[model samples]
Target: MLRRTFSLLAAASVLALTACGSGSPSSTGGTAQGGAAGGGDLTKVSVGVIPIVDCAPVYLGNKLGFFKDEGLQLDIQTATGGAAIVPGVVSGSFDFAFSNLISVMVARDKGLDLKFVANGASTTGEKGKDVGGVVVPAGSPIKSAKDLAGKTVSVNNLSNIGDTSIKSAIEKDGGDPSSVKFVEVAFPDAPAAIANKQVDAAWILEPFMSKALADGGTVVSWNFVDVSPKLDIAGYFTKADTIMNKPELTQKFTRAMNKSLEYAQAHPQEVRDIVGTYTKIDEAARSKMTLTHWTVTFDKDAFKTLGDAAAKYGTLSKAPNAGDLLP
Candidate 1:
């Protein structure tokens, strides 16, 4: 019933970004206009998103008409997973997207002409926060990552942050991460697999991590830092070409984002309600939620951390002068 109510409210509240995007091809909104083919008169912009609480600000902005006030009609496309959204956004299928910082840097290093314009959030607290615990069904006795050699481990996305985290957790405990078989599952569906014993362990994000815990699953361990200690978590990005070609539009977009982020920090509960509108989780569970930190502030450390990760993972063919990519 809450989902139904929230859905109806979401439908009524979200003002499409298309309704306010610049109608003129020449009215560069804020930044320097790029030299590519002129973006035609169209207020509607498709934004790519993944299903997670970090994206709550966008949801709140939609619910509160923030984008509309900024003259952008956003047509949000919830991605099935993080892997696809980066390419989709770069290819123009989406104007901007919420994606893992590592993927964006890897894509940028690969010459995708990407731009990191905003920060979604970072893992906070002394224990670190981006990576989540590795879970096993209640009392399975697979007490450590090392014990799971040759066992199957499921992650929300294959070879992404979840995989990276799982690898870290395994190696920390004297386990050979490569020996384990990795599987992919979405955030919302992981708990059922645990209940049915579909896999030995599930490496997941928070909130979902909370759900796995709530279900009586045993959590082995997790490392919450940026894949590297000083790394950034999630961020919003766009094609470099897009920013170069449409500076004004990009600025307006950033402005709206800044407002929404500030509001998110001020009202976490409202943000959760906005998140619940999309996730199928019940209201009671949603109310007990803890979302990660969100920031619109973009900086060099974030890029360097991402660049370093790419270099370490061989995602970069050659050492990149990370500063070359920053604003």
Candidate 2:
């Protein structure tokens, strides 16, 4: 299966502008613990999310009335990258946000008080499955990871899983990892770029991964599995203050989200049915895409392995303790 933690490296630069923006929850003032099955004053919250297949649970929860069942109204905000979303969450415009562990750790390393509320996505650990892949034009001379040397690869972001995973895959195959060049292209735009030979290979995720393959993009490697066998890639997170000031709201939200996650894992077709509603991928494409492993708990050891890899690749200055990072 494919595992991805790609980045739009420039997002870090946009954090300043995002931090200054403020937004309030849509509805307020019921009780300290309001009418939700749990007890919380706040029943409305805005969530920051990217339009990707990984966000199935959030969309599923909203559409199936899971959030409403728990007495919460979810206001969904779509953004291109986490850089824009993270600041919104930090500034209170978003009560919670979906983000990759790398971006969250980068923010935490810079002193953002964040906590994982639920696990959003993980890899299937099936080596050649539909998780993530580095694809080239059909019948290209590039046959293995070693052939990637001195070639340009397209990733959704820089200094992220796209680059790190690709590099690891290349090195494992005896290629000069440092010789590879990486460029940033949005996931939707990557297939066209690769087909046109703009980049030698494109780091692609599901739904799109299936589309790229249909478009004659040849799979060169699965970058993520080579990085680690089982990985917890991304999750939903909120500020510590949200947890402290609105304990019941947080609990209710978590419960609803956990229920949605369980539903997503158990019902892939149902999850795929709603992916297009929240994202650009259509029903046809959604039917072809591979779903991610969903969970509510962030496994401590899995995160540490990812963190250590990030530090080794210079994504982080030092490896962070998983316990200190999680709530």
Q: Cα deviation in Å at residue 207, candidate 2?
A: 1.7
Cα-lDDT of candidate 1: 0.64
Q: Distance from true position, residue 181, model 1, in Å?
A: 2.2
Q: Please provide, for model 2 over 1-327, each residue's C-alpha lDDT reduced to its tens digit, 9 standing for 90 to 100.
A: 112232323443454345322343343213224545565544667778887888888898888889888777777777766667776676565678888888788777767788888788888777778478899998789998989999999888887767877887888899988888888888889889988899898999987788789998888888777667677788888888778888888888889989989999999988888886767777777777778888777778767877887787777788888876675
Highest lDDT, which number?
2
- All models: lDDT? 0.64, 0.77
Q: Per-residue lDDT of 170-231 in model 1, one digit per residue for the tens?
A: 66678776788888776667887887889988876767777887899877755445234444
User: Candidate 1 at 93: error in angstroms?
Assistant: 2.5
lDDT for 321 in candidate 1 is 62
Where does model 2 exceed 4 Å of error? 1-42
Lowest summed lDDT across 10 adjacent residues in model 2 is found at: 1-10
